[model samples]
Target: MKTYRSLALIIILSLSVNALFAQNKPSHTDSLMKAGIALTDAGKFAEAVAIYDEVLKASPDSKPVLYEKAITLNIMGKHDDAIIILEKLLTSISTPNVYAALGDAYDMKGDFDKATSYYTKGISLWPKDRNLWLNLSVSYSRQKKYPQAQAAAAEAIKADPRHARSYQNYAVAAYLQGKNAEALLGLSNYLMFGSNNQSLGACNVIKSILYAKPNTNADPVAKLEQETIAGAVTVATAGKTGLAPIDSLVLQLTASYKAIQSQENQFGSSFFARYFGDFFGAIATTNYMDTYTRFIAVSLSPQDNIAWLKAHNDDVKAFNIWLNTQKRQTE
Candidate 1:
């Protein structure tokens, strides 16, 4: 089975987190910083680095310029260079942002020990910094230290109860440890406040497991399955213009589901039978797969998929209910 790892996701989230830490500056440096950011956004990393160099020449101690330069280097896969800059920033300025960046840089370099150490130091300096706690949680999770990961995630939640990513971190840690109930609860909270497509995909996989297991507590499983079904419908219907083409979107979705199946298949027939075998069989028998493929093929655009799903909402709902009913009957 595929191990639950979030390194790629953490790297993606770090870009936005760095953006939030960008400092305000005087007009000259501000313009340079903005230009660098634009270049970075346009995938012109070398140009962004040159612009940052110009900003640094003007104000050698410019925190914003240095911070953004480090981020650009990170995007360029220069983790060592980024770490050198971040460590220098920490020596002159003891801000949580610099410490968190240092931690992320080390984590990217696969030095989880140093990453956890820096994250802990950052948390000590800023007890209320939820992102530090979240980063610490991820570091621990990556190291397979579930108890520490859970504790760090709990601290993040305590710092900011409404932060959706904290819940996601906790859910991933819990899921890896086989704490299915806690994982489901954390995932539910994450889905409640976050609209990211990746989170939706994780929710669907977790709900599929819950729906398949026999001798499990029925109440929470039923409630979570229903919520997952409703959330999938909502996501399917929320597309707008300018999204990926319908065929591409269909390919992406199918690839993601296929990954889940591949992971489950590694555990042999008993595990498959207990998890996804019956689930796949039921959907295949109901012609749901045929209808879904047909819809994807005929949809004019990504938005048209939403309209088609809405028009067939009743059928989709019926399939969900029937699938769950079949699972329960077998149980």
Candidate 2:
């Protein structure tokens, strides 16, 4: 009886130890996952993969770990490897993120057809996902299917009205389809909410076109153009010193010319000719006329004019400062 009791006590103690370890196993796995995610965030992709491997050895079928490893692989440009993992994950679980990731992988591989199919599948499963719609729009745009791209972009916009990417996609599709008016509107909307150099360049091009035409219809495009110019003038005049109104006008025009010159690549000589008349002709004609009129009205000697400009140099400096501020803000 004493030997049997001793054996039973040992068995109970062994079982309790095993139960405790079993309860702590998941905690250990969680720690491994957190460490892996940190490494991934720090861009140590290979190290993150190794940690994930350790976690997988414990939890062999962890969907979250598998998905995270696949994303890290994708970031490492191992699109094929990422796709393989994601495809296997689909066999066990069907999630929108997995499908979207597969679409991204195929898109990176230049397999737009496969990307589109995956994106469509994801969209069908999660119709309200703006990102999937945006991805679909991009894929369609890549195929030069502007109409379909526009439709997808519109859907993305409907899903999240504040998302700037949808507007960008819409602008591209509209521009490709020769819908200049709609393209300009979309670009303007993008500029209002987002800051991208490419979008800024496109906005400058569209603004140059509108400036050349000067639509009398009071359309949104015309209003945007007017507002842009007005904003520039406002910034330029913000540093007004003891200069006369005519002097201020001259300073504003000078600031405007500098602004246009800064983006000369976007608005070329043709744009200048169409909007402000020929560059050389404007210098010879309009500029000469303005100078003569100012000289006669002010009746100041060249030295006096120089002195006046030197005194108001702060205004010019202010305009330049304002322009730089705007560029930094937009970029």
Candidate 3:
């Protein structure tokens, strides 16, 4: 359950590279930067760095070149060198992207403390930057600070509700903290965006949680998890013998959503209670639970679910239509 796979570094680095190229107009240096990026993509880090250096020789202090070079160095495992370039960039330009790159460098070097520091600094400068919050969440999760990780992920979600990785980070933290219900809710939300290795692992964990006996712990969170699991189990077993795995899953999830709805008053102002509750609660009330079930199940085995999805293409389209009409709560 402690499995925390973060695509933040690579994803953010790619975004930064693309953003830099997008903002600057065409020029000789721009062409070089694109070439360097192409080289980096081809795993020719040395060649990419050489190209960046060639650009720097002509336009010294080129922010884009410096940033791209640092990124290349990071890919080459030259974290210290990356840090030096990023630090110099910070002295001249103060941007969340620079701070993010520096954090990535420190994180790659296995210095979670330094990485956390830079991510926190970036958040202070640009409080709404979802990438900083998301990366901070990753650093905290790596340090096994589950509560802080969850909180940081909440911020990331608040900043950008559509960012899939934030939900994945939140799910990992919540699941490791024994908050199974919250983890499932986060996983459902993450699957809405796309599937990946981490999301697939989470889907397996969701199955395990649904199948496990109810938690009898006295902790309030455990109690809620117990309630949710009980609801799922009861729905799955009641007069429904030999149900297919996907059918059982749909029933369990529908029941779990109902369980969450039952505790809406108890959930108070927590983000999961307020946001995830409303979103999934709506889906639970719809005829679309089967579609949603198959939708998420696709993450587990895309090939296996392909025929079913193809057969239910119209249902999928209707679900998407209904989904587009649903408004997500960010606050």
Best by TM-score: 3
| Per-residue C-alpha lDDT of model 2 across residues 1-331, encoded as one tens digit per residue | 2232222222222222223222233556767777776776676889999998888887877777777787778767788998999899889777666777788778767888899999999998899877678777877887789878877887787787677767777877866655443454455446545344454365455445333333355545334444444454567778677987556645544444444434333422232223222221233223332342233223223456445545666654553354344311110
**Candidate 1 displacement at residue 173 in angstroms:** 1.0
Ranking by TM-score: 3, 1, 2
Model 3 C-alpha lDDT per residue in residues 35-106, reported as the tens digit of each score: 887887777889999998898888887888888888778878899999999999889778888898888789
All predictions: root-mean-square deviation over Cα? 12.7, 19.4, 2.7
lDDT against true structure, model 2 = 0.59
Query: Model-by-model lDDT, in order?
Result: 0.61, 0.59, 0.80
Models sorted by lDDT, best on top: 3, 1, 2
Candidate 2 structure, TM-score to reference: 0.54
Off by over 4 Å in 2: 1-26, 29-35, 38-42, 194-199, 208-331
True-vs-predicted CA distance for residue 124, candidate 1, Å: 0.8
Give every collision pair in model 1: none
Each prediction's TM-score against the native? 0.59, 0.54, 0.90
What tens-digit string does per-residue lDDT give for candidate 1 at 145-188? Answer: 98688768877876877777777887777666554444544564
Instruction: Specify the poorest-scoring 10-residue window by lDDT in model 1.
Output: 1-10
Clashing pairs counted in every model = 0, 0, 0
